[model samples]
Target: MDTLAIVILNYNGQSFLAKFLPTVLANAEGYPVYVADSASTDGSVAFVRTHFSAVRLIELPRNEGYAGGYNMALEHIQTHYGGATYYVLPNSDIEVTPGWLDPVMKLLDANPQIAACQPKILSYAERELFEHAGAAGGYVDWLGYVFCRGRVFATFESDQGQYNDNQEIFWATGACLFIRAELFHRVGGFDASFFAHMEEIDLCWRLKRLGYEIWACGQSTVYHVGGGTLHKSNPHKTYLNYRNSLFMLYKNWPADGWLWGKFLLRLILDGVSSLLFLKVGQWRDVLAIIRAHFSFYGRLPHLHRQRKALLKQQKAEVPLYPHSIVWDYFIKGKKTFEAIVETSEK
Candidate 1:
């Protein structure tokens, strides 16, 4: 039997769990539902234990963010139940649809080459609009800028059945990612050092490097509250985004240009982007970008070792947009997915 486990990693998101967990259990009738709580002191563990008798709650000793939380939780699961064939990693804030698992699992089962996939993520507050986290699928530019198929920067497209077709993609959103358990473990799981943010893209990049495809199961859909752990505009999230992005690029090596040179350009562009924050006196954000670069530098030695080890098994060129997403999105005002889709072919 092909056992699939739905593991939701949560960190002090009791409200989200209370709001969405019932729907998850209702929709996921047969499959086992697990809530891996990341040391949430807000009585999340007690709440789950008291209210949700059906959920298999695994309370972590400490908060290790998303990467470490899942790594630890999945390991615990593997030991306890001999593990499932597939794992569905969902953020606590997502409200899953009925039969959400079928299309994604079917796609994965039909294609052994596909290691991971995600359902279409519509905004929980604005149901008609695609969420910014993983709008359709996700893509990274040659400069390591990660964007989604139906989202460019902050622009979230409305779900008009435009991206209903399933297709291969560079990365799946961790907000509700479905991945083969074997492949997930085989890839060493996520880089826990990332803490959170961009870790999914990093994992997908490694799988793609091994000749595995990541996909968007547009047939399945989920509503995400988006940014349960960290709000989109939070400075810490900014730090993680910039720093983990650098971490991802270093670990997965860009398709062109020297890594440092590209990073230098990224630094310049990041500085330029900070002008927006500077205009509004959000110095913490400007400082967050600066801090991200320093963190990247501090981790270089360890990252270099990781790069060498990871590349030892590399088999394929990592897929990335050949153009700079910054230039296209900002300079040229090509704010839509359609405007940039043609660039992939050119």
Candidate 2:
């Protein structure tokens, strides 16, 4: 019957658990913490049960990845601990700061329209740099290209207090997300089909369509080891990210001329990315993007059905950037987020 509950999802991340659990447990005052284990074979369950006995555990039958695991865990939390007003989904590899939850919780309580928010995420390895996952807050371009306020493609801005103000954002990072329990279920939770990347953005986009806002609680901060489960360098990670981004676009975007135009533009961008990888002799990465495109095309009928279902849930038109991030970053040489914003305004 607490006001907040922290649920950390684990899948063969015993090392991460061992390293980061103490900080989470230490900072988790006035709330309960649970480790939702998705059939971890690395003795993560045993480690938690033995060392962190105070933390509750939810054991899943198989590794359902991030979207599925969280969906399952949140369902359990809502059903069993219905009294909890907020659910904090922090990655297992995050080193949370003390009072991290207060700012986000206060923001949610103060604003009834905000369905979710995230703390400022810094890099665990290089603490001065904004983490790739969710630096300050998340945003997307017209072409479905996702970026953060402090991060662009392969470029991260240093934490220089520029993004210190709490502000409304397109999406909150799933890394240290604090969401309203009721609103989360009402949005039908995350699309489990995502299975990994871009799922949080999809969920936030859905919430936005329903006229709910998302924000960033910059006062509350956390350091995340960017790629705990799937390393950024992995070709499979590239495949999932590329494919899921397309899936998200298909489901959320209006299926008119706009959708096709954006999809074509994204395809061109993806081709350029593939050629860049080819130039670097990253054959696997190039192939991953190609495979991702094929998979997306193959799944269009199913995704179209999902798109129709999502349209039925729309209460308001979601906002999106009219400009292309690729043109801004690559063609115009706008490196930092501040520069991008400035140029857009001009």
Compute each candidate's TM-score over C-alphas. Answer: 0.97, 0.98
Which regions of candidate 1 deviate over 4 angstroms?
255-257
lDDT of 1 by residue, 219-269 (tens): 999999888899988999989998999898988985355878988888888
Worst 10 residues of 1 by lDDT: 254-263
lDDT of 1 at 109: 87
lDDT accuracy of residue 244 in candidate 2? 97
Candidate 2, residue 67: lDDT: 96
| RMSD, candidate 1, Å | 1.3
* Predictions in order: lDDT: 0.90, 0.91
Cα misplacement distance, residue 149 of candidate 1 (Å): 1.0
Q: Give model 1's TM-score versus the native structure.
A: 0.97
